[model samples]
Target: MTWETGGKSEEPDGAGRRDPAPPPVGGILWSVAGDIRVLLTLPSALTMQVAHPAVGAGVDTYSVFRTDPWGRGERSLRSAQLWVYGGEEAAEEGRRLRRLHRTIQGTDTRGRPYHALMPANYAWVHATGFPVFRHASAYLQRRPYTPAEERQLYAEWLRVGRILGIHDRDMPQTLEEFWPYYRRMLAEELELTAVADELTSVDRPVPPPDRGPLALRLPLRLLWPVLFPPIARFRRFATIGLMPPDAREAIGLPWTDAQERRLRALGRVVRVVVPLLPERLRYLPLARRARARARRPG
Candidate 1:
């Protein structure tokens, strides 16, 4: 009736299976970091939706439910209500979604429809399902929620059920529904990015002279070493099969030209500087040198 790991033990369920350990804080941190990366790289319009207050609130509510479903009590009900009204921002978001939907509805270029561009809008049901189940399991295991939180969580669950066209009586009692939702959400994010890019291109024009200071544009020189390596690795990992042999003749990884130039510049700098430094100072000094080079005027 007990499960043990790293000398820690907890009671097992009646079925005699031990409970899985809680996910490490590191994984949660990494997940947030990945979300940030995706947000930054995505198109402004798509990123705006993810950053919306309502969406953020939903994600927070979802995370809390996943982490401690029973603990949500009254807070869970509040979250559900918030979601129902789409928070204070729903009207604007609804307008944007409608406009985006219209923009993309029949505009598929390669046999894929415009609706494909707003994938995330249609993925709401899937996006909310997994955390609900995951947290429900945790709630059963830990019994940490006040009665109020449990009620609220259930309220939110009921609302989600309605939105997704799930019958309260027929809602999934297990985790089988979670995976499909996650996949659909990811696919929607990809499609949304493509659509956003198209919108940006169509709207491009000269900026006003008094448009004022840029926000979030750190000097690329200062950011290069700190930002480029991980970005390069991520690009490589994400694009393993991005191009077919035939397509490579006409198109390639979007970064092929820029990446080649940066890598060559990096290599040239490394070749000239590495041997000049003392062996003891090489690794540490190399970073400083890279930073310095990044700051230099072209």
Candidate 2:
């Protein structure tokens, strides 16, 4: 959440001049469960300036340093190296690794200093681990990070990036580029729960038909109705402020002067529709059924 960039300098001629900060150099950091992954991007030169001195000095200084995944001790360098190198190929691998790392680490959408936990937990569940079960359990428990711990993790990310030949000037932009991949990974993980529910349902047993016509047709048919109403609603609400300005801006869908008028018109229609629809029917029945079945005892 705390994005830093290079510092600016004062100008002469009475028109205040400023210098833009350098881009982030790639770096590595530790997860809450104490695994090292690259940071890939950082905000300010000052931030990295503060963190640069401690790379590889010892486990205590490194963020990803932990004796074991859940062990309450400093991590060994071997553990950090293992986490960095696992199943990775070496060509521009640091950038790819950092992108994957951020997707799992989750960002502070609200611009907070620390990363969020839920997404990290989701990532840990899917990623193969070194000390496997111990790391997984730490994620499940949602442990909080101490101030020292946060700084340490940040430092480790920077260190790893340096080792991999990632330069400081290229760090921030590199991380931004990698953001999309993280989002895709999170979306894919969410889709898995839906798949699991469908497979386990007794009433909705899998069809024995070969993967042919029925397979192609059923999903399309099922999705068509589900999408139509929402699309209609979104179009109707398009002129209204269906989403907050900041949310739209964060996702790069900033409103224009024309969009403001459209949003207002859409809002008006959505307000009218809300009261007309039954509460139970507001959500799609398919989604509701899935939720209901998920909660049922085995």
Candidate 3:
């Protein structure tokens, strides 16, 4: 059987009916995922995906990440927000990604067959969210997560994992279970493929997001290209700081005394400053739209 969404069709199981998509992450998930500060951890999360050999191979073969870095990153981030907060839109995005990935299976450079749909690759992507929730909460709140909040946040990400086609049985159930798996993957599975290094090094400038107002937009457009290189440089250091020591070492990204100092200072500035803006300015407008949609899910 087949399902239609976003003008694309997907094959389902022999039964015409489909498993219902999980509810959107709310309560704890929204509180954590909604903050723009969560973006601070994005570089770390992204590098983790490509560190897996299959993920690296699939990205190089299938994605336009290098040639159009900003567009690729923006599209992926929008898809993620849709998956997390788009309600039925989230479900459709799930099927959409699943369909796109179905054709991406092939052999890697060393003669290993790799499919993007496999549990391990998806699981690794899901696992990156653990640190995102951990640090976002800590950074925004100026404190560590209590054990209960960590467990709840981990559980919420597992639902997100399901939406992304990861099976529940293949995922860790708690924060405690997550760390060991994360460490093991960092130690044994991650590698700095050429594509990944190029990705981490960042070949192009990142453009600013679409903020309303010609006034704001005009100045940002003129200024952003000028500031982007320094911002990109800071992103590299920030990525290193967020990563586990083993992962950064394996990936061959440098973390120097100067970078460490800059990263800490950067964190202090963003953590202290971003949340003080009026609530409307504090997060993405797309998140607000998605959140409203999630609440009214059919």
**Which prediction has the highest TM-score against the true structure?**
3
lDDT of 1 by residue, 49-165 (tens): 322222333332223323342233223222222223332332232223233223223423234333422334334422343243223222112233454644444444444444433
Models ranked on TM-score: 3, 1, 2
Worst 10 residues of 2 by lDDT: 37-46
> Which parts of model 2 are misplaced by more than 4 Å?
1-241, 283-298
TM-score of each: 0.27, 0.22, 0.81
Q: What is each predicted model's overall lDDT from 0 to 1?
A: 0.32, 0.30, 0.67
- What are the runs in model 1 whose C-alpha is more than 4 Å off? 1-86, 106-121, 124-221, 231-298
Model 3, 7-35: lDDT tens per residue?
23466522343544544456576764656
For residues 131-165, could you state the per-residue lDDT of candidate 2 as single tens digits? 12122222222233454643444444434444333
TM-score for candidate 1, residues paired by index: 0.27
RMSD of each: 20.3, 22.8, 4.6
Best by lDDT: 3
